[model samples]
Target: MYPINTISKGGLALVLAAAALGVPLAAAEPDDGELWAGAESRIQRHRMADAVVVVRDALGRPVEGAEVRIEQKTHAFLFGCNIFLWGRLPDAGMERAYRERFAALLNYATLPFYWGSYERRRGEPRHEETERVARWCQQQGIVTKGHPLAWNNADPPWLPDDLDEIRRLQMERIEDCVRRFTGLIDRWDVVNEVTHFDRPQFVTIRAPKHSAMWERVGQIEFARQCFRHARAAGPHATLIINDYRTDAACERVIEQLVDENGRRLYDVIGIQSHMHGGVWSNAKIWEVCQRFARFGVPLHFTETTILSGQQGRGRPRSTPWRSTPEGEARQAREVVRFYTMLFSHPAVEAITWWDLSDYRAWKGAPAGLVREDMSPKPAYQRLMDLVRGKWWTKLSLQTDQQGQGRLRGFLGDYAVTVTAPGKAPVAKDFSLARRQTNRWQIVLP
Candidate 1:
């Protein structure tokens, strides 16, 4: 496992106590600016590993001076965007552009499974549509995650008024989705936004029927039941409890989402950061990481939105928001910074951008990495530079006298080609991850 070099809970409490008492704690901690400046170093220390590639002949003789080429294929850490536009674009050209750009940059795709839209009618869900998208994602080597198996955000219009029946159907839906997509999509946001499931604003106006059903079942009980059903269905799946709030409210809900045996139900903790209002400060981002790291589960920034438009004050639908040149520039800079911080933090395993394009983004806000016309934004290019260029590893090396070539590179899937003088080129694929031994042997033909 990758070591987390952050302060422990006890140490953090001591630091807090010292601060409260106006006492100095050994050395001062780095500020936000310092953290940003040192992000690259942190990334190198945490996100990379060293591997020794050994080359030999079929007779087990060391083949010294062999030329070896290493190239990265995919990231173990998921960088994703919602594939809500998979085949839903306006035209074939737009669809083609979307697929090309998405596959070029991202190795993770979030498939939409919103209850209201996914299954508009009872007993009939959009399984074929979702399967088509999942198949495409598999073909492109992208990991697929279903967004929200359970949420009070919206309910199907065909939902029944009986609370008991609603609960049964909800659990059945969770199990069905999890069981059906077991291998195709092994990750899920099991229960979404339970911290504010019955918030007055949402319960009254947004999803009254769903909220009422959730209330009757009780918040913690609802989450517990949903997680249990999901776990039973997809035992090997990475189930997550997702929430928008980063405060104590979220922590409370997560703390209580345990089985009868006191074991946590979720495999990951999903945090939503919709920055349509504004980008979160560096300090806030780091604080969120620290807060969630205590759960001992990987953190997935499930639905992140860094808008490439002027910040508006009213409701998203009511406001006329458009992406501008200046805003795109700022978005590019901040996107790099935000992603770097998250990537540097050890607890964060994945980061999923909200929308891939602004064509039909949530709330009609301009929050896509690409524009409405399927053109790349500055943010898109800058992120590509980081994810595929700077963070990616490509190298050429010669084996030493011991027939070993050593390299330190970012942890991910890699392809290696070894060519010795007067010998056929030999190629092999390997993966570099934290938990596994990274040594590989390539026997030349």
Candidate 2:
């Protein structure tokens, strides 16, 4: 999609998660019928009970005899499989591939940054390959976005000391990439974990020159800088200022996004909630989503982890931990809860898990929904329930003569049973609505 992006066999293969060499999915069948049906049922019966999608002519008058297509704004869940940070995970190539597959199931792919590994080799940037995967995701009807453009861990060692130079370089990187991949992806996490920059190791490996990020530029100012420049690049992308603390720091960032002077700098408010032994409980996520809603911007739970183990990518390389059966089950249950919450939250628009399978998880976090063998983990089922089980279910819809069908459904796939009055009920399939319009070409028999 962009000149800067390069696609390779590495990202196309599941080999990174050991997903390649053979199988595609786990043991469960891929009959998307059930999931789509259930998800649609919720929309038709639960959400749109009082709402109506009336077909109207160009004159804004109802056309009864003329076939009608009811286009209603229905609530549906948006899901993602995470692309982990580099060095924390060894394969940059596979990062793109896994994200491509993630696009296949969910609405979009979420990529985290490992600025160390990204710029580790100097002049050569590691983003192109990932950018290639993002392009591929677009081809596959997947929406893609990065985790952070500016974060504590995103700068390399050779950064310039001059604020002008740093700003120029950072903006250059964001602009170049954004302009390159503008059409492929529309959203980005402009920064990450923005308020907590006190970590020793993160501070230790900083570039020799511009090591003082917060000191030189306030977090909000830096965030605004990122947003403005990235916006200039894509011109059509949604820039986000993201952070984490399990506290009120995120609120401050929200204030900046809504500030009279600084408000134009942001499009979405991103949050990081790694459910490390915890779950994104439906009620809790609904509450967390409220903060962003106060500012009237959409929300994204950007970096999420529901681990079945005790270790992490940021681990000190000495922690002792392992995955347990109970832990795996809990992880699965938590995942279901997480999706339920995001789907239910009025303002929460997207939810991205760190990885699909545990094979290449950052530092071996047992947070993958699938195992290395591509076998279904309990969490996989939890997610599959949303994708193919609930959201992607196939169901029947009735269409009028104009090739338009109306049905009670969620925001996904549907198989409409079109009967020509006395003709057989010929079922035609079409994917429902998502970030963009969902349309299908039907051939009548």
Candidate 3:
């Protein structure tokens, strides 16, 4: 078998040459059925952990045969969607539906930080609006992430002509945003799409000024500066390097994002899987995870899109695209498979859907989990089944002679209730985490 490092470092040509000379290459890609056959086992092995709950009386004696109830309160794994329409829906009813549906299903929310729209003016940066959204997410017990602290997707119209000034302002913005929302928003996509920083499409139309600044500073330095600024401002923040490309170019960018000590500066590696054209095969999804898992940091599927309507063909159409019954069914099935594969991979930490609703979805593609009327689609319902039903943990157990009740469950926050025959039931909360000991001790009054 070819070493993964060898194949990643431009050694594919050697494999091809060997194949032509009657030499066998690495193992063939596994079929879909074969790949999925091990998914449940993988999820159990990697995502679930064992815990011991010990119940004691006020006199420090074992409370034998105490009933212990465990119910998962939240997932340690982040299942999320971008909340661009948090309160921007057309009407109050739609807005309520959006909030209710999002909170019911997801525990993580990605807030937009696109530079052009976020800060239309030089001194103003929409802090109040972003705070409002972040506050709402916090109230709903959701984790909030700011996206694309530095990207050339769109440049603020007031961006200065000078490259030096532009660079200064960009770095300042990163530091300011990270500092200002230090606790409310702790995770950020520090540098987005750096591999395609100067793509022709962006340079010519959408972000000419920002593209020019990126070219002047060089990609690696530009990314390094942005990450450094963010780290300086929010030292404990989770910084990510995000890109849509999953090829060697993206890998090269990640390899260079290190500090003077050669330590990785970013906390997470963000991969964008915008499957507007079609869903990726199971093998490809597994391959991407395998390739990036070498980096040692967690992987976040940051921007994922699977269309529930006919994909755009030839050129963009002016009419709105609507989700179909057949397409929604297909999307639901594909979403389950996609999420199952990613969740089973130990390296992947989070998956964020691109849009929450079909209304004003990116490029008007029917990629949301809900339809335009703010109703849940099949994809949404099926995902809810997996994330909350099959994957969630709820169990009842009785304490043994040693006052300890042992059980295995998916990692998350749990509410534990201990009830003894003649004593009032005692309630407490605890978290099951891979990094911490899962043993808990509860004292009954």
Candidate 4:
């Protein structure tokens, strides 16, 4: 196996009445096997079904030279979750539990890079904390990614009145991040939520009148400059243009990013699927994918969250968003379906679930796969069933005359065991990257 390379949900309703009246209602959980099957159909669809490998005997001889066969087992997928909690949880037990649980399931994590938080005061960036998180993720074999090098929501407080200086500083910020995180964390949401500046209420934090930065330098230009700076610094990094809105305006921004020669300014198209209100219909989900797929670029569902509690109906923080048994059950079902849809789409490369625990989740909503107490919720187990349990690849096969055996399975890292008459079994590791043919040679003992 390649060395551990340091890389770097929906719910709703009905329960509100019960909670108000001090009564509870039960929510139905989808059949585990059925959900797994649906997810498998998408995960192992046309894109990934089989891998071709060759097994050699103890003497470094192929089946053609010495009869040999092998057994293969898939260990994990590149599936990921976000760790935006400044790299540590509150309670010691919770922190250990959180990291352990997170490492068990996810191989990727999205680190926070909000401008306001990282550099609330210019020249005093919070690098030490973020670096700690990135290193921890690396030690756990999880790839780390930085989010939104440029975002209006997390705008710095010490901006000058000059638009040119603001633009210059924004580029400088991107440069500093890409340079600092060169290999520690390469993937970045170069520009986030760029599609909707007019939606005043959507801004998560303070913003100047008329959204000064984007307006001063045309929105498109501002985005282009951010990407340009990021690309210059971290050419190997996966630069993404992300947004929460899936409207015509977003599509236009996507189209404008490509050059006259059809070269794109960004590497990935990031879409946020915050299902706090409720799960989106399959048709609507497909429509959004098809719309973005038109750009012919890889897509990443950057920030997805589904509540395991009563939705806040637009005031998630002020109101109570308690998780009920019914709500969690429903969340499990919807989360499975949502992930299945995204995985099946050929254009999608990754999906980062927004929150891991309900504790201090965005706006303090119960949107985590795990409860605050560090117990696995139905959604968490359901996802595990799809990713590592049912959809995983494990099988034994015999090699043909050419010392070759074909194994059809999910895309991930695999452990191959080779055994032959009078020869002890030997193990070898190989990986199946998405859309790439994986070939391996395993020598027996």
Cα-based lDDT for every prediction: 0.87, 0.57, 0.88, 0.73
Instruction: Kindly list the per-residue Cα lDDT of model 3 for residues 157-251, writing each as its tens digit.
Output: 89889989999999999999999998999999999998978889899899999898899899899899899999999999999999999998888
Q: Which residue pairs overlap in candidate 4's backbone?
A: 27-326, 50-408
Query: How far off is residue 395 in model 2, in Å?
Result: 2.0
| Minimal lDDT window, size 10, model 4 | 1-10
Best by lDDT: 3
- Sorted by lDDT, highest first, which candidate order results? 3, 1, 4, 2
1-445 in candidate 1: lDDT tens per residue? Answer: 1212235344564445344322234444456897788788778877899999999999999999999999999998999999999999889999999999999999999998999899999989999999999999999999999988998877788988888888999999999999998899999999888887887877887678888888988889989999999999998999999999998778778878988898999999999988888888877787787667766677899999988887753444655788989989999999998999999887788999999898998888889999999999999999999999999999999999999999999989999999999899999999998756699899998
- Candidate 1 structure lDDT: 0.87
Stretches of candidate 3 exceeding 4 Å from the true structure: 1-6, 10-29, 312-319
Pairwise TM-score winner, candidates 2 and 4? 4
Flag clash pairs in model 3.
none
| Candidate 4 stretches greater than 4 Å from native | 1-42, 57-77, 201-205, 260-262, 316-319, 398-403, 433-437
Q: Give the TM-score of candidate 1.
A: 0.93
Off by over 4 Å in 2: 1-76, 84-104, 198-200, 205-210, 258-262, 280-283, 310-320, 397-406, 412-445
Better of 1 and 4 by TM-score: 1
TM-score of each: 0.93, 0.71, 0.94, 0.84
